[model samples]
Target: MTEPILPRIRPAIAALAPYRQGKQAGPDAFKLSSNENPFDPLPSVAEALQHTTPINRYPDATAGRLRARLGERYGVDADQVHVAAGSVSILHQLILATASVGDEVIYAWRSFEAYPSLPLVAGATGVQVPLTAESRHDLEAMADAVTERTRAIILCTPNNPTGPIITSDEFATFVARVPGDVLIILDEAYAEFVTAPDAVNGLTGRLHEKHPNVVVLRTFSKAYGLAGLRVGYAIGNVAVLNAARATGIPLSVTSAAENAAIASLDAEPELLERVAVIVERRTRLVEGLRAQGWDVPDSQANFVWLPTAERTDEIAAAFGENDLVVRAFPGDGIRISVGEEGSIDRVLEVAAGVR
Candidate 1:
């Protein structure tokens, strides 16, 4: 058979791999790969999802109610809030709005998997600054790297996989060093789970007021247990958020997601109780892992990072064989989410052997 010629494809897009999710565990295995809420949905969330809104019609393109609620909570106008299917979607939208070919998007290395991926989608090159030995953002180096071509900068606090958060002081210093014209994205997807006293609080401090170019991205997926529903929001200057909206697919935020997000907000107290449980589990996991002679990073988020060095793949396979599936990054480390209380002991047991 003769080979057919393929249509022209962008060299960058052709070389890129699709976003890799955590491995799916078998039926009997406990999946600690994805950082997910272990508890069932709150009553309000379930009730909201049962809404009789006819799905035949398109949803409110702007997600008005949710935006209004978020605005009220954050002390911002509704116009200052932007809602999307997920925080990750908002990221791509913002990057598309701010960057283009020859521009650069800067972020910490081995941070959120999406950070390295988003810029390319916008036809912008990604500038990944290496994380410090403690697995934290080297904000000083990042600030020093800023140039005229730097269009967007993403700072993942309570950074995914590695587990350390950017502190308030660090954020202040970094922001001051960077040019005001460049867009700064604070990806706080796991913000709700953070317990450190001095960690940067985004919307609560009215960040956009202090820094117009800065935007904070948060999601209903983590603490609210609305992962599958895909609702996320960004708080920033109305004009900046409007730019992001211009680049986004309209009506992508469904009615179900909006309703569920609102319900999650209404049941915030109850939802936070579940978060508290996860935080306790994180404390146990960190302390337990260190006791086992494993040098685990202190995680404010619900997941813990286990640095297995050259043994990363082998240790991950060992975990899989024991029916405890985790996320492994080749030679780097493994990220184990705080799962059921029973799984805690199981994870520690597995780490004991692997260590």
Candidate 2:
């Protein structure tokens, strides 16, 4: 049979590479590539997924109950909360809603991998300002780069992969500089994992009141151990969130995810204890790497960064050989998630050898 000819496709999308998740591991290995919660789902969360979801029927298309629940948690009106499959989904929806061909979306470089591609998918241009020497966002540089064509800006606090967070003061100053018309997405995906005293916690600070243009994104995928379930939300002003909701695919969030997330919230006290454990582990991992003469950043998230520079690929392969699965960014560095307790000793041992 002859190969069928393809129909017309957008030049930008056709050339775009798909999002790549972290590397998986074999049974004998622990997958430390994805910055996932090391703990299993709590009893309540599992029970909700098993019993609360009725698979034979479609879920609530609007997820009204979940929206109200999250709104209460963040002290916002129901219309101000937008629930989607994940925070990343809301990101795509917002980019599509606000930016389009000939416009620009700005974010920090060496940030969440999704930042670069999400803009292209929306047919918008991306402007990436490099991080500071200490591996934190150069917010001033990002603000300076914005133009009249800029429609959206995404800020990942406890910035993924590298792991430093944007402090509350830094955030306030940055917001003041940005144009009111530009949509600012403050991705707090790793907020629960942060242990820093001054780091930005959007919900606690009531960001919505002061910055109507900014939206805070949170996910049940990280600290809640709901990664496989796929549930997340955005809290922002009514008009901005409504615009994002309009662009989203209907009912992409299943009843299973919504119920599980609600259950997770019900079990917040227990879940936060587990987060404390991960934070402690992260502290140990950072100290261990730094002690081994490696240039590791102070991470407020569940992962530690190894700024391997030219040896990124080589070092990543070495870890793989030892059954320690980690994420590598070619020439940049490696991001090793703080995983099983048993994995810690091995990680330190591997680092000692590399040093």
Candidate 3:
């Protein structure tokens, strides 16, 4: 007998692959596949979670308190701050809000894995400008690629998988060349870990004030150790944020997450000291990798990029055999998060052999 027909699906979505998360490590292994903070929730954050109330009621759709707190921290008005379940959720909302079937979204390649997929899911064409040989965004090439069809552009500073940051001067120059009408999303997911003096600080630098189309996306997932809570926010012009809010899923940011985020802010100094520890560990790991004769990038984030090139799979396998799980891109390289201190020696040991 003939099989029954199935419901129709969008051709673009039908051909698209879902986002792939980093591989989980076994109980005996160190999980460095995801760029996660190597610390536990602050005591204050934990205490805040204990006080969550009204389980039967829905969360504040506007995330008012959290927005006000973040706005104060960033020196922006509360209406300019938009909180979502995670910065990634804000990304989806922004893409859906600004882009459409015939429009285009541009970003650097070998950057965030999610960048390409977001546009496809939104029915917009994705334009990828390749990174420079140094594994940094080729901003000039990116500027050249923008056309009238371009609806949005994403700039991932202290870029994922590869850790170099976009300097303020470079970013300023790039922004000047782009058309003012296109929406620019600056993904600063790892901002708190940045120690580079010249690196672009979207919030403090007041980039949004200069470029009204620009939106800065940040998260508590990295430095604040709130990955599981999924708390992140966007600082932008009020109108742009409202558009993103329109596209967002209602009440996605739970009250518990908001409370924990507020508490994390309250304990920022203590949590930042934890960040300093991770930064130190990252420096040690990078130095060790360099001593092993590896051409590791000068990462400003809490991770290092090993340009293993054709040897990516083999090196990744070597790391896995040592019970150190890392994120590997088949033809590119591996991105190892600076995790537990104990994991570093093993990482260096494995790197020695790979080199």
**Whole-model lDDT per candidate:** 0.92, 0.91, 0.93
Give the C-alpha lDDT of model 3. 0.93
Encode model 3's per-residue lDDT on 201-302: one tens digit a residue.
Answer: 898899999899999999999999999999899999999999999999998999999999999999999998999999999999999999988888889898
Give the best candidate by lDDT: 3
Q: How many clashes show up per model?
A: 0, 0, 0
User: Which lDDT tens digits does candidate 2 get at residues 63-179?
Assistant: 888999988877778898899999999999999999988999999989999999988988889999999999999999998999999999999989888999999999989999999
Specify the poorest-scoring 10-residue window by lDDT in model 2: 48-57
Q: TM-score of each candidate? A: 0.99, 0.98, 0.98
lDDT string for model 1 (65-153, tens) is: 99999999988899999999999999999999999999999999889998887899889999999999999999999998899999999
Pairs that collide in candidate 2 are: none
Which segments of candidate 2 are over 4 A away from where they belong?
Answer: 1-3
Sequence-dependent TM-score of model 1: 0.99
Question: Using TM-score as the measure, what is the rank order of every candidate, best first?
Answer: 1, 3, 2
Our tally of clashes for model 3 stands at 0
Q: List the residue pairs that clash in candidate 1.
A: none
